[model samples]
Target: MSRSTTATVARTQPKRAVLAAMLLLPALAFGLWNRPVDAQEAPVEIPAPATTLNETSASATAVFAGGCFWGVQGVFQHVAGVTKAVSGYAGGAADTATYDQSSNGSTGHAESIQVTYDPSVVSYGDLLQIYFSVAHNPTQLNYQGPDHGTQYRSTIFPLNDEQTGYAKAYIAQLDETGLFDGPIVTTVEPQKTFYAAEQYHQDFLTLNPTYPYIVVNDLPKVAALKQLFPDAYRDEPVLVGTL
Candidate 1:
């Protein structure tokens, strides 16, 4: 990382560290902390693809970067077919996957979520619907809501050519349908190494339900997922208990 980028991440780390500390006190966390609500824009329920896989196998992995992984992971964890939704770094080298280093914006990594789901229970296109809708805004370019930087970019890292075809077609469908006020900017890239984030970052939304950041930014996405796709919503979330 460049000297300037290192300085930027170094400056950001302390404040986030302090926030982590303050999140321990529930009463204080609720009373003292307040954040501006994200715009009231809701995830639009787009149409399921007319064309989809003729059949899905036992299970598959899909990695998506649509802003902060916390909300994305939280949203997918509530989906019925999703067995696991892990917060991680993708679209970059494996060695530079560490959070602090990636935050400097030189690693070409995006805060992403690796979801393991049963295709029989839910097809990949179903996951894409939730992703395009309640998971995160696909039109936000490199940022999602409050978070900014390439690390939080909107990207879809497909595991294979079939997955890539699905993502590309979906983006085209949404764009053609004019699902959002702005154009969709989500990119479909070949899947690369996905390094799981640190333990504290795992299951963050479930474990830290009352954390200020989760309350203001992430929880609502889960709520929206439940509201928008009631059939697929699961009351309990699959969480990563340890790193």
Candidate 2:
């Protein structure tokens, strides 16, 4: 079955029960049973952007699309100063933002997350640091891990001119670092509309922690965040449900 189809089937109660049972097995056995075919991405150690936004706002919003939003959203939700991390669609029209439509990969929409955060506690540059380092692999083109398509492409939708400059400069800085295996392919897309995904998709990683995809492809990201950014990692994620 395709990833999409497997995800759909996993949502059913029967499949979920089976998955929960699978989780009870020994760690090595469970891992062997559910290992993904695609090699997982490991967080990179990249430096802070030489340039950062000077905005004085109490809160700010940023949109990012890097492969599946499940892991992306999960990573930000556990970060300090992040008010909310919502999985959604960007780089396309509102009408084409639905998962069903975007899944076709021709709607020009990539699975994205709109992150609301406090600049005072965590500057835009800090968020950029977390984004490029642990959230997803920016070097992959039109895909990440087991997923493949334009909908999984790496991108950033800057909300303002300052953010635009910061994103572009940060990508350039990372490219110069030679930290990634390949050049960063993340695009800086501005003036795009961000439509929240369907209710079921919101907070998916937290709600479905035992799901095969979440376990195989996303949980490591949260672990990486805690290990790499202990000061910025929060024990209790600021869930979208509470926002």
Q: Please write out the lDDT profile of model 1 over residues 1-243, one tens digit for every residue.
A: 753333224424533554555556666666634544444346677898768865447879999998778789999999998888899999899889988788877899999999999998988889999998888888887777656788888899999988889789888988999768789989887958788986667776786776566776688788888888999999999887776
Work out how many backbone clashes candidate 2 has.
0
- Cα lDDT of model 2 by residue, 74-146, tens digit: 9999999999999999998988888778886899999999999998899889999999999999989998876
Candidate 1 regions with alpha-carbon error over 4 angstroms:
1-40
Q: How many clashes would you count in candidate 1?
A: 0
Q: List the residue pairs that clash in candidate 2.
A: none
- Residue 21 error, candidate 2, Å: 16
Q: Show where candidate 2 strays beyond 4 Å.
A: 1-29, 32-40
